[model samples]
Target: MHSEEDAASACAHATALIAAGRLAEAREVAETALETDGPEPTLLLVVARAHMAEDEDDHDDDAERVFRRALDLFPDHVDLLAGYAELCLRSDALDRPGRHARGPVLLERLRELAPDSPQLLRATASTSVLATAVAKGPSAALVQSLDLLQALTTAASPEAAEKDARRRAALAPYDRRLAVLDATLTALARPGRAPLRLLVRRRPEYLFLAQLTVAVLLLARHVLGPFPLWVTCAVVVLLQLPLLALRLLLRGARARGGARASGASAAGPAPAEPPLPAVRPYTRRQLVLIGAGAALAFSAFVTTTVLTHLEDIAYPRYEAAAPYTFRGMTRTDTGDELDTTAASDPSGRVAAAFTYFYTGGSGDGSELAVTASTGDFHDATAAMVYESDTLLSSTPGVGSLDDSWRADAGAYGGWMQCSRYVEYITGEHKAICFWADKGSMGSVSFKASDMSHADVEGLARTTRQTVLLPASSDS
Candidate 1:
């Protein structure tokens, strides 16, 4: 109250309280400000409104006194004049027959000052002239209708007057609904309302879209590749679930403001609308369901992590298989590499693999490998040709020969991915065949001099027979 800033804050708080239907509290705040802050128009209006909201009868209401005081400061204030005029009309309706009543005179004044004033326009309807416009009410536009509502204070017969006053009182409240609507509209123009409207209506949708977009991107997996992107996305979804839960916890903290809030009008029933459904927290059932989903999501993440770690550690699990043999050639140098470091580059990760270097009588040689791991053999082969860092540095490739390639893994057997490449000035063929059956997985890769597509297929089949079959069947 000491400063304009303080007064404005008080006014905002009081208005909010009023909007919340805390009229008694609103009145207390407004009244305190009026007494201490000297006379500010907005504060006066609040005080008057708070008083009008509480007063039940047309009898001498305290709202009138506050209105008069506010008007003394800003006499032409559109809201003040309209509010005061409405109160006067209601007051005069009861045959309080002292003057045609101040309502008519005030209306005539407002008619000039703010002719289209929502309050003034509304008050015009309540004139006994328009009272007949309300069905089953007063019969005629009395109060000296000839002079145009101004002669409401003119003397009339006691019997006729008493009858008309009774009619006015009954018809007053419902008569000026249009004005109430207009006044309510005018009140809606205020600060911070647009943002609240967005929060209550549009922001939730945006949050859902953002969450969906993130989920889609994560699912695509081009970014943040440490974990299975799908699982990571699930985890992210869970993180955002609380807000997203609203529908879509928005299933997150949902801004579910469904019904609109309103209080009764002071001047002829302030416009009212049925409330929107209220914003609510998740119910017990909803919470339980969310908790169940969260538990599952967390469990999946843990399970995926454990499996991935197991894969990285899968190295020493695969029994070292014997190298294959060919006519007039021997697996002269054979060795294997097993990478057991978890979270290292999984793409190039050879959990366990055996490589055979074969030497023929004419110094012709080839390399063959059988690998078992969680990493994809397809990427391994592709990355080898492209020399991408995703593959192991030692991964072998006949440089720039990736163009000649064909693949055919008929459902029953892993056979047939062959490529013809030139190496050491000799045309040769390479074959990579991969297989996955439930928990069993591995791939066969062969590279040799002068090997044709048939040779590639034959070697792939022989490699499978050499590595995957029982030792006795290798014969």
Candidate 2:
């Protein structure tokens, strides 16, 4: 071994010797070749593995020393770095947390050098703790991590979680719960899954997400407008679509982001890469209980939402008192003279006008006007009359459409929006607000010289509460 090529040739021979089970001879040949030739990472790799392969009680210590020495001389060598990292992780001998600590530091270095390297997967796969691998981001690509985890879970018993985790007395980053969440649970759950459970539990992620979805759906049932049974049921199932789609999009983005973290492709013909690493997951029975509990919880949640919102399946137009007082104002009928404007709505739902003026709200001569123009609003009333905000704002009776903003009608199920602007030539400063809940929808207008937005919204809430009562007692 007189030249670099000779050293390379020698590294190959030593590797063959180690593979042939001649550990002592492999060490000797590699060390001798290093003296004859120059320093070589591959040769040192051979020597280190020979020590690692030896049937001694402390083979790790010897192999680790060789790797450390090689890395010191050739700190940037890919194979040396990968080999050393694997050794440290293998013995659970991570670097102490420090400025240049080895545990996380070694892992970071490998990530920088070959982020997408198959060798990284191989080196880190043997690590007993899945938590360490999964912290922030998995050490390998998501696809590789999934593959490694699958391998681990395959070996794990469907019932023995503690058996595989092999918990230690001291707290470490790598712990049992990480893989046990699904590994063993997947096994136990797989055998008994009916079609629905199969669909629900096919991906552990789906099972968890379904629970999350149920929670959100329950919240929506009360807040959304009345729907017939069909619409309500459709809403219950369709709600999961957006949540699942969001998660899947996020997962794919994470995979793409990690895969592109580094751009250090090799310049020449790429060297032979390591094969994908095998994984061994620990399985436990706790997840089975968790899944069962989750399934039950989800079912109960869905049933509860549908039943509680049974009131939501129908929206009978609310009955209104003929006369009422709000704040400092009192309501008076505007008489039998037809409100031609209300009758002009395209859908005819806004044809029956419940128009009134609540006067005496102020000594400054300000009055609050409310109009419940009713019609076929529950179905499709053109955006112009009962169903439209923009169209309503543009209507002749809604003051001038100068400036407008949306306001909430609180408990009356606010589709109530506020508009603070009015006509081209009128000196009157009016703020108008409107609300919609199925067939029950109306507007309130404030005709005060200096009425603030809050005043308008406040009066609108009072008006909606007074007029939008549930169906009259008799019917």
Candidate 3:
């Protein structure tokens, strides 16, 4: 039988790897211990950890199974239970859209078992708030959760009461963690206090370089003002790669410097190692170029951002389409009228007309549109196609719509006009007149007090009939 020291050392090594975020290495270390020593409760725990590291999809039913096996060996294991519950929460098999879900039930069980446990309480409360938020968007759920958290934070527990005594007696080290968390929360809650500013201050070089690259993209956007912000962001990301490399190089240099310092301190005045190689300094010309590039990048970023904001503020775009006559052109270049008088109403109505479109006549008909809609222009169209087809296809790729979908969804403008465009395209050709009301949808004649999911669905159905697929086209 192995000595206690050997087992403890193995455990320590595995734990160190885990703390260093070398999870794969930790798993290997753990597995080695288990394989060499034999089956044990701690070995099972380590094996479960290895499974967790391997499971990228977060579908760690295997890990859960291992944890359960560990629990069987050593019952009432809090860590194992916690891990299992977390797994359940991540997988949609447990916590779902419905009111009664496995996640909620599991959480309730956890609460019963560890009511006063601060960690358990925090996790339960946070998850509860998250679920509520998912069901009802952020504004409503965030406020409720914040209130609950604040109230709970104020209460003194048995642990808190004996903090000083516990600290002196060395009975509790983890209690101090609560104080740190509390302070962090307090700082986070402070008004007009931007944490991002603090982040920039701490890592000014990284932020500066990143933002400078972003600015260069914005300058490009300013030069070619029609490009979408998302596209600009993509460009910025691509441009920033070189800077990211530079940052990594600099970080490596710092790490080497730190290592050198640590070695010097540890050795305690080692015979001066043959005078260290002289470090190269930046040339004046190189420094000037770097400074100029930085200045230009920053200037571009500031100018582009300011201009974009200014443009948005000054010449505010409207959602609803302006009243215009739509005539099929008889002549290509001129406004000569043809047979079709396809005029769009001020509402800009459309309908969901399911049809298929050929991609290319020359190519092998591999990519043919199965489900296409006229009015269903937004993300819903693609979502519908994917949802309908996922069951049939083994390997799903290239979602419902093309790149044009985003542009069609009004990528160029703000939400206001986009909202109207949606109404026009989606709303059943039912006359939807826009007004200056803070909250309302559709007809001015019928005043809308509030909107429900059913109301939206009803509107969708109506839009399908009236605008999207007019009876004439269907018949």
Rank by lDDT (best first): 2, 1, 3
Model 1 C-alpha lDDT per residue in residues 97-209, reported as the tens digit of each score:
53238888888889889877677777676555455244122211221121111112232532343344334423332222222222222222234333322322333344444
User: Would you list the C-alpha lDDT of every candidate in the order shown?
Assistant: 0.48, 0.57, 0.39
User: What range of 10 consecutive residues in model 2 has the weakest lDDT sum?
Assistant: 168-177
1 or 3, greater by lDDT: 1
Candidate 3 lDDT, tens digit per residue, 60-140? 666767766776776655555555555455555434333224556656666777767764654454355466344333331
lDDT of 2: 0.57
Per-candidate clashes come to: 33, 15, 12
Model 1, which residues run further than 4 Å from truth?
Answer: 1-264, 267-297, 308-320, 323-328, 331-382, 385-403, 406-418, 422-455, 464-475
The candidate, 1 or 2, that scores higher on lDDT is: 2
State each model's C-alpha RMSD to the native: 21.7, 18.2, 24.3
For all predicted structures, in order, the TM-scores are 0.33, 0.34, 0.31
Q: Write the per-residue lDDT of candidate 2 for residues 1-475, one digit (tens) a residue.
A: 3877778777876775554345676788899998888677889899998886653537767887888889889998877877777666655433322212454567778889989887677666645457334522332233433442453345444344323322210121111222222232333244442332233224455555556555555545556743454554575567566546434443443344323221222222212321233343323453564576487657767776676756445445566554567666776655662345565666555535576777877632247767775444554222433345665645565555665666665775637667665544565667777676655666777764566667777767877777656666686
Candidate 3 regions exceeding 4 Å error are 1-9, 36-39, 50-55, 58-62, 72-75, 90-102, 111-241, 247-475
Best by lDDT: 2
> What lDDT does candidate 1 reach at residue 8?
88
